[model samples]
Target: MKRIILSGGGTGGHIYPAVTIARELENVEPVEILFVGTPNGMESRIIPEEGYRFASIPASGLKRKITFENVKILCRTAGSLWKARKILREFKPDVVIGTGGYVCGPILMAAALSHIPTMIQEQNVIPGVTNKILSHVVDRVALGYKEAKARFPVQDKCVYTGNPTRPAIREAKRDESREKLGIRPDDFMVLIAGGSRGARNINNAMLGVHRHFRDTPGLCLYHVTGTRDYGNVLKELGEVDERGYYGSSSRIVDYQHDMPSAMAAADLVIYRAGAVGLAEVAVRGLPSILIPYPYAAEDHQTYNARVFVAAGAAKMIEDKYLTAQELIQDIEELHNHKDVLAGMAEAAEKLGKASAGADIAHMALELAGKKGER
Candidate 1:
């Protein structure tokens, strides 16, 4: 029997990748998996709901600048390291794997100090401070973006496995999804989603996009404005149906629960450049206009978008410069030029790593085997 410990949290991006890897590990073979995260972090709720054993440690993010709080955080981190060590000693796992999050820092460090086989998966082109520090101690580093390797201190240990996405993302079928979404075969479906909480800039820009395409035939714009912006976005585009449909061409929603189906039905995507979202876009071979969130840690979202831009899979529009005209122009260019759209789609397909979850799981098992041999 193989025992594996997975640690990551704070957000869905960190938690879901660990869940995907756990599912892949189970698919490959029978294994006992334990998820470790901060008690109040999002993972504490999400991990157990996914039906994995869950554990918690005291963990918090470190402030970037030198401050009095940094001293207190350092003290708390030391206590978390002791707790993590205790958990590892009792669980006696063969290998410990971390996805990026502040919570994973002490756990991975504890595992490394115990001489346990350890690995960390970095999901962005710009490595997070926690993952950057852990890279020195972990045995192997799985990279969600190959471009991220140069940012890590120990580049030799890094392997480009790409980011793991939910299985539903890969399983959603375009024709079926399009039919379900009431989109016709001849229609060009454009999906605009700014992460879950929603981007106010994207929503504000789309007020013009909806008006421009209102009566256009053969073009469908599906916009998710997020909860905060939903009412305002709907009110601004007046004379809409109860279903938030405007004219013959646009439908607006507060949130999209079925993103896989949305992506499956989309001809083009206008999205924020979160690593997990981009990973889904890549595997689905969807070309995108990326607007990276300016406030992300270390400006990592911009770096993540650059990889896609460089790969010819996406066009980047920085948030500061994002306007209705810019979005409309990009949409027009892509809409009019089928060749450019097809080429971008092809480039996206080339960069897709549908096997990333399985690859990371296999790597974990190999490390487990190495530990046994030693």
Candidate 2:
């Protein structure tokens, strides 16, 4: 059996893609897969739960500016490389792939130096520093956004494969999903989420949206306020009942565990512009109102949002200027114009790479086969 090692962590954006690709690989062929990530990252827990063999190597991000702490991190990175190399030697994998994160740096770099077929997947228009550096050494760079190629020095190595998401995302049926979510067939379901931790600004803005849409027939607002802000958001909207319903049509929750179903049920989405979320939205052909987190590293979320905007798949509202009024106006415009909404949905569908996981899986196996040939 071909052996493979997949490494990436730090956030869900990095972790989920690795998991998806691993799942696809298993479906494609009989392979032995091992995941490597930092011991402290969420991957340490998530990968094991997914029933994959996982190994952890010490890894951490470097500070941007020169500092004593950066020096210390460099030393730790050197140690990480040693550990990663040791793992590779022991596993004897045919191919190694990294999604994107500081944790993957040492692992991918070690694989390259060991002459193993290696690749890195970047899931944003602006590549992370880790992926950008690894791009120079790895055999191939799989891009979530085609626009990201210009940002990398090794242009020939880059391929636009799009972002991988849960298989359920592509398979989610609208009717079934809506039924599961208690949404009517004719209800205009507006799904609002701000990532796993929730965005306070988004929660705050939704209060106004609730006030406007409450009791509005044929409209339902399913808002996810995140765990930390749920109580505060509920308190501010004092009339909300114990069940987190503000009006006849509005429902609030701290999190949405069934996001694929939620996305399938949604007629429109208002959320942050994280690449993973965008990938899910695109696959579902849902038009979005994107409010990028202004503080994201290098403001990459805005760049990701702009790609959708340029494609006519979504509208961008900078977080600095995102008000309930602005959000409500955008929603009303889309709700009122069926032709425009349909066009945007078509555009989003055009951007979806539902085959991304399969493509990357095949790519990894192809690289492994080539190495075996050599």
User: What would the TM-score be for candidate 2 when compared with the true structure?
Assistant: 0.98
Question: TM-score for model 1?
Answer: 0.97
Error of 2 at 18 (Å): 0.3
Off by over 4 Å in 2: none
lDDT of 1 at 220: 92
lDDT of 2: 0.93
lDDT of 1 at 226: 91
What is the lDDT, from 0 to 100, of the residue 146 in candidate 1? 83
Q: What's model 1's overall lDDT? A: 0.93
Compared with the true structure, what per-residue lDDT tens digits does model 2 show for residues 134-154?
988999999999999999999
TM-scores for all predictions: 0.97, 0.98
As for candidate 2, its clashing pairs are none
